[model samples]
Target: MTPEDRFPGPELPDSGPRHQPDLDVLPYGSYYEPEPEPGFEPEAGYGYTTTSGYGGARFLEAHWPTASQQAHPGEPVHPQAPAAEDPPTIELGPPLDKFGKPIEELNFPYPQPEPGEAPGPLYVVGDVHGYLDELLAALHQQGLIDAEGHWAAGRSRVWFLGDFTDRGPDGIGVIDLVMQLAAEAAAAGGYCRALMGNHELLFLGAAKYGDEPVQSTAGTASFLAAWRLNGGQQQDLERLQTHHISWLSRLPALALEDGHLLLHSDTTAYLEYGESITEVNDAVHHLLTEEGADEWWDCFRRFTKRFAFRGDAGPQAVHELLGAYGGQRVVHGHSPIPYLTGSTHLDDGTPPHVPGPYIYADELAIAMDGGVTMEGRLLVARLPLN
Candidate 1:
C-alpha cells in the first residue's frame, strides 16, 4: 500500500563507490544523424494525429494549444537542444587496478571532486541501464562528473530517477558508482539520491530469493524470469545486497524541491494516498514502511506500472500529477524518452534514444528519460533543463 510499509525503515546503507568496466560505448554522432526530423511521419506507427514517436520523443503538434489558449508563466517551452556542442570524446583507458577492466572504466575527464564544494552546475541523470559510453558522454556535456564517474565539481548534486539496473550489461556497476557518488557528493555538499525503481524491487527478490515465486501483477512470476526479460544483466546479480534493497525500498515515491516533482514513472496513481501533496507523499511512505501486505505490494506494483503521460490526454495527466504532487510539472525517468518520443521498432533491433535533450508537454511536464539501454542518449539536466 505504501513504499515504507513494503520495507520497514532503517537508515539505508550507502553503497560506496564502485569500480567498473565500460564497454560497448555508444558511437558518437548517432543522435546527430542529419535525417529529417521524425516529425509527423504519418506512415510511422506514431502518426501525427497523436504525439508519441519512435523512442518516446514528444511531437509538438498536439501538446501545444491553439493560439487562443493563454499560457502559464510556469510553462517550460519544449525547446530543441542547443546546437550540438560536441563534447570531447573519451577513450577507454587501462584500469588503475583489477577491480574492473579498462573497457569498463572509460577515460574520466576531470579532476576528482573535492568534498564540501557545490558544483555550481547540477545535473539529474536519467535511467542508465548500462551503456556506460552514453552515460560518460552526457556527463561530459554537463561537466557534472567525469568519465571516471568521479565528481567533477564538488557540492553539485545528481539525482537519479531510478531503474539503473536491468536491461543492460552494467547495472551492478552503475549502482556501485551511484551509491559511492552519493556519499562522495554529499561529503562535498552535493548529493546523489536515487528513487525506488520496479526493476530494483525485482532484482532484490531474485538475488535474495530466486525462483521462490513471488506474486506479481503479471501473475505467478519468479523474480529471476521477469528480471531477465526486463534487461536484468546476470553480472549485476553478484553486486546485489541488503543495503541496495533497503536504500531502494525506502526511497521516496516523489521528491519536490523548487517547482518540479521527480518520480520514476509518469502516473498520478500516487493521488490515491491523499488530496494534499505532503499528505499523499507521507501516506505513501508510511504504507511502504509498516502496513505492507499482499495488496500493498500490488498497489505499489500497479502505481509503478502506469505510464499515463504518453497518451493522447497526456497534458491532462500532467496537470493531474502536478495538482496532486504539488509541482509545476513532473520530471520523470521511467518511460524511456525513446519510447515516449516514438514507438519502438522491434524488428530492426536498434538502440533506444531520446530525440534530443529537454522536452516540454503543453508546458506542464518535463520528460528527462533519454533512453540509454539501446545505444541511445543518457541525459543529465538541471532542475530546469527544460
Candidate 2:
C-alpha cells in the first residue's frame, strides 16, 4: 500500500470559515521520478521512493498533536498503534562517504583559513524528520552540497534545527548525512551543527531506557511507547549506531549565531535550564549523561512544549528568551509554519503550503519548520530572512 493509503490525511479541526469552495483536487503538484544516486539505493519498508516534487505519495503526513492533546507534559499527544510490525533485521553494509567509498579508506585533509578571512554566509535548515532525499535536494538547491551530496559550501556555516529522526523514512540516514556534513564542513573551514530537538530526547530515551517505565503527569509511561506514539520509526531504531547516539546526545539544546538564537522548539522552557546559553547547554548535556530516566523524561516533556511565542504575550516570551540567551531574534523548527500561521487545510483534505519560514512574534521570531511531514516544502534558507 502507498503512504496515502497507509496514513490518510488527518481529520483536523476547522480553522474558521474560508472563501474557497471544496473541490476534488490533489494537494500537491506533478510528480517526477529522479534518478537514484550512485550506490545509494532507497531502502525497503521506508514508505518513500526516489521520486522528486511535492505530492501525497512522496510526502507522508504524520499526525501532529493539538494543544488540547498535548495538555499533559509527559503524556503523548497522539497515541496510536504502530504503523507496521517490527521490521526484520537487515544488514546496512559498511559506512560510505559521499563518493560511495568506504570512509575508513578516505583521508579528508583540513583546509586552513588564511589570516583575516571572514566567515562565509550563514544558512539554517528547518526540521528534517527523516526525509533524507528531501533534505539532500534542499541543501543542493541552496548550493550547500554538490550533486554527489558532499559539502561544497566552503567556509559557509549551516545549522540544522534538529528533529533529525522519526516520523518519515530514513531518520538514521538523515542523521548520518548531517554528521558527515559536519565533518566535511569543518575540514573546509566551515561548520555544520545541529540542535537537540524533543524528538532527539525521545529517540535517545527509547534507545537507552526502552520499555522501562517512567513517571508522567498522566500516570506511568515508557520512552519506547511514547516515541512510537509520536511517529518514531522502527527502522531508525534498528539502524542507529553508537556514534550516531553519541553525536546526537552531545548536540546543544540552544545556539546563538549571528545574533539569531537558534533552537528546535519555540517554547520558553529553555529558561528553566539556565540564564545563559552556555549554562543551558551544559545543563542539558548533564541531564542526558548524569540524570535518571524521570529527569530525562521531564526534560523531553518541556522541550516538546510549543506556541509559547504565540498570542499577545508572544513578544514577551521571545523577549524573555532573548534577554537570557543574548540574541536579537529566535529561529526555531518544531512548530510548523502552517500551525503558526493557522493556515493548515488538513481538515479540508488539502496540503498546507509553507512558502518559507514564518516570521512572527512581532518580527522577533522565525519559524523554520516548513511542515514537510504534511506535504509542505522542506525549507533551507539563508540567515536574516528578508
Candidate 3:
C-alpha cells in the first residue's frame, strides 16, 4: 500500500474540527511531555520533576530507583524477589579517547574485525534519539561502519533497540543511515534492523493527522499534543517524508536473537497484544495500519509504559514474559540505565554519567538506554553477555 494509504489522516466529522488542523492552532513554544505520575518522587539520589519549567528539561532528571531501592516503593506491586543477582557487569572503564576528564567512561571493548572476515560479532545499540553524530561515532567505535558511514562489518550483526528519532537533532538522518546500513549489511552477509519505538508511532500519527482528536480513556486527545509533550522536534516533523513514515509503520515491535528478547520498552504489555514474539510484532504492526485513532493511541500508550521488569516482583515479571515469549533474557532500551543505577546524579543538576549497560533486575533484563539525551553514554554492547 502507498504511505498515504497506510497512514491515512484522522477521520473528522462533517462540521467539527479539521481532520488535520494547521500548526498555527497549537501553542508556539516548545512543548514537553509530562513525566508520568506527577508528584511521584524518585528514590533518594535520583530525584526528578516534570514541572522543572525549562522546556524539556524534565527529561534530563533521573527517575527509576536503583536496584537497591527497588525493594521499596513498588513493593506491593512487585512483591517477588529481584530477578537475578545483578550480573557480574564490567564497570564503566576509562574513556577510549579523551572526551572529558571528569567522569570515568568505559569504552566498549569492540573486537577488531579480522582480515577478510564475515560479520565479527553480534552487537546491540541503545537509543539514538536524533543524535546522528553520536550514533555514527558509536558505530565507528564498534567497527560496525567505516569512516564514510558505510557498513564495514562484513558478517557482524547490529540491531538498534529503537528510538531512532525525536528529542535531538537529525532524527531523519539517523533513520537514513540505519536504512542504508540495513541494505549494505545484508549485501555483505550481515544484517541491521530496528524495532518500532514509541516515537516512531508518534511521528507517524502527527504527520498523518496533526491536531485531530483521538479518543482516549482520559478524553479526546491528539497526536500533536502527545508528540510535543514527548519532546517532539519541529525540524524532525518538517523534514519527515512519506518514505520515513512507511519505514516506521513496517518496523517490528519485538524480536528474539540468541535467546535474548530485544524490545523497545520494559513493560509486559506486549503480552496483552499477542502470545509469541512474532504474534506480538504482527499485532502491533497490524494495529498501526488501522484507521481508528483510538486504537493507534492505545498502541502508542502501551509501548510507552516502562519498568514492568523492575521492582520487588521484577523476577516474576521477567519469568512470566519469558514463559510466553522465547528468550532467556530481555534486552530493552526505553528506560535509561543510569536511572536504575542510583548513584548516577547528584543534586547539582548534572546529568548521570553511565559507563555501560546497567545489568539489573537480577540480570533477567538488560537496560540499553544509556540515556544519551540525558548526557549519559550512547551504549553499544555485544550480545551473549560475558
Top candidate, metric lDDT: 2
Clashes of 2: 0
- In terms of lDDT, the poorest run of 10 residues in model 2 is 22-31
- lDDT (C-alpha, whole model) for all candidates: 0.52, 0.69, 0.64
Off by over 4 Å in 1: 1-121, 215-218, 274-300, 346-353, 358-360
RMSD of 2: 17.6
Q: In candidate 2, what are the lDDT values of residues 160-267, reduced to their tens digit? A: 998988777789999889878877876777778888998999999999999999987656888898888777889999888777777788888888776788889888
Ranking by lDDT: 2, 3, 1
Off by over 4 Å in 3: 1-43, 48-120
- Best-matching candidate per TM-score: 2
lDDT-best of 2 and 3: 2
- Candidate 2 positional error at 373, Å: 0.4
* Alpha carbon deviation, residue 324, candidate 2 (Å): 0.7
Candidate 3 per-residue lDDT over residues 243-318, each given as its tens digit: 6666677788887766678888878888998888767877877788865777887787777777666555566788
Provide the lowest-lDDT 10-residue window in model 3: 16-25
What value of lDDT does candidate 2 attain over all alpha carbons? 0.69
